[model samples]
Target: MTETTIVQYLFKRLHQLGIRSVHGVPGDYNLVALDNLQEAGLEWVGNCNELNAGYAADGYARIKGISALITTFGVGELSALAAVAGSYSERVPVVHIVGVPSTISQKQGALLHHTLGNGDFSVFANMSRSISQVVVHLTDPTIAAREIDRVLRACYVSTHPVYIALPTDMALQKIPSKGLETPINLSMPPNDPSIEADVLDSITEIIYSANNAAILVDACAIRHRVIDEVHDLINKSQLPAFATPMSKGAIDETNIRFGGIYIGDVSRPDVKKAVESADLIISIGALKSDFNSGGFTYHTNTKHTIEFQVDHIKIGYATYPGIGMKSVLQKLLGSLDFHRIRHTESAKSKPPRLVNQEAENSGGQEITHSWFWPHVGNWLQEKDVIITETGTANFGILETRFPKDVTAISQVLWGSIGYSVGACQGAALALKETDRSRRVILFTGDGAFQMTGNEVSTMIRHGLKPIIVVINNDGYTIERMIHGEGAVYNDIQPWKHTKILEMFGAKEGEYMSYAVKTRKEVDELFQKGNEFSKAERIQLVELFMPRLDAPRALKITGKMSEKLNAKMEDTKYA
Candidate 1:
């Protein structure tokens, strides 16, 4: 009942912000906050570790646009930073709240758990400054409400990571009523006004003039929830549309306007030739990151180039589009004289090829990631979700066919390993709340799995039965490819695959594991997973295969590394 209790005040503010779940583990510094969470209508989502908790929060925010997490200082905060960095890079609005020692304790210079014997409360906060947009310490009740508003604005408006340090004493302090008040309107980015006409005119000119024009989009277009409009723009313009690796599901693959994924790293030579020869390029909601651009910049010599974003338009040739992609596309569609405009022969043309009735059919390739994904894609339910980690799964899924009804999500920016397991946990939880029959399927490598495999316990405890598929290729397959031969350092220690269920204390017959190698075994495991998903149990399937070929990007990187090695050898003893 004391007014100075910090946890009570903090919870009041969280409730005002409409945050229901605070994902993290309970620790000495944060116990008081955890105790007050239930009363504030906030559920404590306990994960196996802080890293998992951070990933879960990012997953939630991916769906909700904003979410929160709590972790203890130092080790917990440091572990959680990976996910925060991921959110920052990917533009997810995830708020990270870390618990620290009280002001009095810090003044006394007392040793703390997981600390580096330092008495600085800002140590953890400072470490996160590189990735987080804003890092603040909640030590003063007078400025508590203002700080909450500031951090919330930074997160919700910019859609980035924001960190708040909660000292033990501050969590117990009482807050003023104004600090807990909900606002009727929230701050958001507005479309650029002055440049709207210029953007439309420039794009119109390019479309009117080009022999072959194409729009290449990446993950941000999907993350910002504006892919639908971009799709409409491309379709209405009658222009060919291609997507980067992370932007696969932005439009239905079967759409006639849709072109196959463009992999600059391992591009099929034909695709690269098409992009290079194009006269006009419009990149909407796409980031020109190294992973997407094949390490070389594009549109350097293209006569017309433009980028449409939420806030402004950046044009490459002469004029910039300041209008939002959605608004500009909507206006263009409204004003489009479809009868007068004819798509160029080059843009409308397709190479001679056999058209298969079963476009989604898996290729007849045994022991390949691309071959396995299409079969799984065919089994997806309307509302089903796919969670993939970095490496083979990320790049492989780019070419894998997905049903129009299913949603796919993965970390596109930070590309952290071991993120899929925890993200699946959060996605499953979200699906449960929406009264959706959707299920979560996780694709992870064995090496990445070991990093945060303990997160399976969270699923058991929370009643989340996501189908976990562990690709057991022995070690870091991507690294081995990057370094070529004699890269034994990429291997991971073997695990007792089937014994994981017992180790996690899961119920017998409820938890199952399979070591799959042949095609027959792969089909059996899928059938088993489908059967177990209906029942109330966790299923982990271990897939065994040789160190197979990875995605095109990895193959390219590995080849580049081999060339560097050969060059070094030539210089040896000189």
Candidate 2:
């Protein structure tokens, strides 16, 4: 019979479930448990702050399938709540483990340093339930192993964040480690055989009968880990496909059948017509909100749509329960006859225009948003991790053509600023574990960088080298364009953006920083292939662009938002 402490058991189970590293800050309340993390074969990434740690874990999970974050009871957990909420909204699986006071201290109702000083320890856990898909409080040592497995399974299967409250004393309590022998069962529950067959039959019929069918993928396709199945269905069916902005990397953009990024009305003319006019649109893992939909303007008729979702199979207004995207897509691929399917509508559309040639020809004195993004396409090597922050960076990246094997990581649904930086840390660390030579490239605005820029210290501490390009527009450019063009609130304190690498403790030859305003300087930077491409030194570029300039997509979205917000204001007092 094997045995281990509760903390050791927890970390070992996480390691078994493919979590190679845990992200968080050290807290006095959880020092003992933190000490055991290293012995359990898990790397502990100590971040500058708790929130950034949560963000890093969220990003890491997207690449590695699952990730974990550790924090202290009240203050640390609460600070990381916003990041966890973003994970919940985006459907990224993250296990948030919180270390609480000891059983004796909690039973006596002693005032805790991290608490509100009212002796109430349950308030934060209750608050966490709202954001986490599963919440477990490990007060009983006998069941701690089981509880960890259950919560982690929920996080994996649901593709959402789960919370666990670990009492300090209980973490050191000896528990039977037999549970570690069995891996967490991530397989889907058995679907009703008859219902599953019927759903597959219906899905097969839809696939064979449609003359103008298209596959529209979204973020959930990546989060739910059905990308391979999605790719298979697209190939076997030979249907024209388009990915939402959230799914930029889910499918091969070079494929002939790829229509374009379909962002409702804001989509390119050909892309809009192809998707809206299709007789049967097989939307796989498509869960997006008004922001992603360009103000609820998607023209596809629900009556003609077949959606392979996380929990259910939705086909033309009829919802079949107990069906999942992975199984359903696999079954549909087996039954599909490519000869019978035709992209009657999608075939007529031209390939989506990724770069505007004229913009580059007429280079203004200042760096234009249009020219910089496409030019970036030339510098990107294959298999690089490209992460873009919210605002202009995320939207602008859609115009950039990605090479083969490039993974696009962005917080499209969450739209969280300061996300890409922390995410870069985790992505870089996770990338290193695979032994794959990948460079983590990040594009974030200066405004967002100020929010969580200190997370770079974690990268330096761990010797992770990421090429971070700070879009130094001097303010929140997206917010100014969206609602307040001249508002002082959109302005921010501008730092010498190029000084970041030095400030983060990078010595000579270890890091490089640049500030470029003109297109000439930008070209010169990219020409230094040995400097930028070398994974040994971290690179930072402060790209100075026109403050008022925005990406084509963002400009379109901002106008639509203004009209929608104005309508809302008009109706409020009516």
Candidate 3:
């Protein structure tokens, strides 16, 4: 039987899963395993810190289907917990590998530097169990290969993060390579034939009976890899389709039947009415978190809703378990009788117009969120990857329409403040490996940028050419809008934003930086014939905006958030 080292087998499996790079910071325990990465035909993305590594891994996984993150035991793993938890909350697949002390040392309970110094080795793994779908410690070499495959399979199947703890001694232990001859079973099990048929019949009946039916796509459609099926359903049935904020780019924006986003109370008047007034709504992969749903303000009745999830389908008050959306959507397309379904006029929604008259009239005025976002919608090209931070950028992006095949990355449900900067690094790297011509654009606020800003250096080191747009509003604008308008806590120390690239070690000619305070400057920078538009090298643009100005939808949601917080406080005291 052929044999390979334990760490080698693990890396080989990740490579098989299409992970070309591994993201993490190095430490003593994990140092030896890092050597195996290159041999296994994977690149090492050494992040500035473990947290950033975790966030980058999440971003890579979002684009590439699955990713690997490695960290040392205890401190390194703990630092990445927040990012991994965010992955779990949003259902991204990440394989988290932790290098631990030798089994002999663990058995003797030797005091370790990164440990709690209490001779207890299981504490960190215990903490990780809550956030991971599968947590495995590979102590027995004979079963190491099986355990690794098990956790990796779970990660891909469930579309959630999984954890693996590999002791230092286990890194070099001989393991049989025979199991790798067969690929891990990454396919989802088929639904029960009888149950699936019944569910499909019910869905088809409702579609035929309803006067007006609409399809509502959410993040899960993308997560579950069913975008094609969803599009087929919309096209064949001729039903108007709407997307939630998290699923903004899941469907082609130019589709005539594509309505604007529906975020409960925060949706545009026309969009809100169209979605809520529907007699039947086929909601696929809907994750209705507070912010995603406009502070839990979804007005659609449950009885009129049909929700298709990864593992089940819900129609009216009954749920059909053991049924996944991929097969169901495929079968639904075949069963639908197009002649019986009522098709409405194509949705009137279009990307917000590029030139706002009011802004155009005020020629030299500072850029406002209202004007900037819509203008961006017009400037974006097909196949661009846009990463938005969880502040004004996230809400602002909702107002913009994407070109075909553009992928939008954001953490609406998790809402981690500095996630985008690190995510941009990973995304740029992923795109570089797959499609170098495609651009990676990052829209981040100065406040959030400060948190993971160091990751920019990683981009510089790897020769990544991403356009970093810093929304320099002087402070946390989203927080100010929510509760603290003039409070010092919402303020941040200002930085000379144009000097960031130079400070991060970008040599002259390798990078360009601009500070645009007015609309004309923004236009001049992005217009045709400009170097910024070409994206041939790393560029940073400091976009100046009024500190208090925000997206219209953000203002509405912020007020609702404040009210919810106050109500919770009152409930606590009462």
Candidate 4:
């Protein structure tokens, strides 16, 4: 038997899961556990704090399939709770390991410095249960490995975060290493053929009879790790596919059958008709949250829609329980004849969305949002990682069309400001470790960047390379658009954005920085042969624009924001 401590076994489990780095802030309780990370051959990414650590892990998981985050008891775990909540809502799998007081101390009810001045140590663990899919505490050495396996396997199977409360003493306790011999079985329980066949036959019959069929995809396709199946279905069916805002980069956007992004009323007239008028709309991995669904304004009737979800299949009002989407789709794609349905090639195409001349032109010293986003769109390279902040940048990015293999990372549902900066550091490092050729590109507002600006130091410390574009509009333009147009609170003091690299620790000429005001400067930087086009080191470019300037999509979302915000509070039973 390979004898190993609980902490060592935990790290080995993470290694088995393909996690190369563990992100967190070392605490007194977790310090002993952190020692085992390196011993287990896993790198430690000490973040500025636990929250950023959690966000980094989330971003890393979005790219790397899974990630691990470590924190200490009460204070540390609570601080990272918000990030975990975001992971839960967005379905990103991150194993959160929180080091806790030793079992002996807890048994004796000893007060801890980070605790609530009380002897009860169960408060934080109880709170963590709300957001985690699985919660395990390694108080018993005998069951520690089994508990780890259970939690981690649930994490991968559900693709959700799990919490492990590791007491200091238990971390060092020896455990039988036999669990290390076999990999965790990530497979879901075998599907019942009777249930599976009925669901598959139902879906096949519907699609076979439908004349105008459409496919609507969303972010869960990416989360569930079925994006390849999605692409394969698209290729096999040759039917029109439309992505919600969260699904922008999920499919091959350049495909002829790909209609366009559909956001309720904001959708282009052609996309609106293509999706809304379809006789059958198969929405795979569909997330009907208000933002992705345009304030719940999807036009397709339930009778005409078939939804594929993680554990169930919903056709109209009927629910087939226990039939998983992964298997259902696989079976459906295999058995069904795709050409039985009609094609969308004959649908009349609408003219492309028009932009203001001033937005595209750089003749003036002032940079407008209209010109900025589309220009940025043209500059996006294939396979580049794009992280946009929650404000105007998120909405602005919708205007850009990504090339193939591009992975767009954003906290759209969470809409956390300053998330992109911290997430960018993690995503860039993830790409660097996995594929050095693909680059990480960030689009964040000045207000958002200012909140997590310290992340630059961490990025530099790790010797990572990411190109950060700071959209300087003088303040929180998104807030102003939705609520306070000219309010003083929406404004933020300006900082010299490009010089942040030097502030973080870059030697002279070690990296590139640019502060561009005119279109000419932007064009020159994005031109094919420019140094900014290639990132030999961390590149920071600050684009100066008017305070009131905002993307067209943001303008539309702003007007609807009030109505949507009101609807958010509507009771579920109402």
Report, for all candidates in order, the number of backbone clashes. 11, 0, 0, 1
Which regions of candidate 3 fall more than 4 Å away from where they truly are? 346-352, 355-364
Angstrom error of the Cα, residue 272, model 3: value is 0.6
Q: Over all chains combined, what TM-score does candidate 3 have?
A: 0.98
- Descending-TM-score candidate ranking: 3, 2, 4, 1
lDDT per model, in order? 0.71, 0.85, 0.91, 0.84
Q: What is the per-residue lDDT of model 2 for residues 1-574, given as tens digits with 9 covering 90 to 100? A: 7788988988888898888899998887778888998798888899999999999998899889889999998889989998999999999899999988988888888986987888888899999898899999889987888888889889999999999888887888888988888898988776677888998888778777878888899988888888889878777777888888888878877677777788998877888888888888889888768667767889998988999887888989999887777877777677767777765754335664555687977857678888878778777777889999998998888777777678999888888889989998889889878755888899999999999999988888888888899999979998987888889999999898788888888888888888888888887777746666666678888999888999888998988889988999999978
Error of 4 at 154 (Å): 1.1
Clashing pairs in 3: none
Candidate 2, lDDT over the whole model? 0.85
Superposed Cα deviation of residue 302, candidate 2 (Å): 0.8
Q: Which parts of model 1 have CA positions greater than 4 angstroms off? A: 1-19, 107-115, 178-181, 184-187, 297-302, 317-341, 348-366, 524-536, 561-574
What are the per-residue Cα lDDT tens digits for candidate 3 across 93-183? 9999999999999889998799899899999999999899999999999899999999999999998999999999899999999988999
Provide the TM-score for each candidate, comma-separated. Answer: 0.86, 0.97, 0.98, 0.96
Backbone clash total, candidate 3: 0
Candidate 2: give its CA RMSD in angstroms. 1.5
Query: Can you tell me which runs of candidate 4 are displaced by over 4 Å?
Result: 346-365, 566-574
What is the Cα-based lDDT of residue 481 in candidate 3? 88
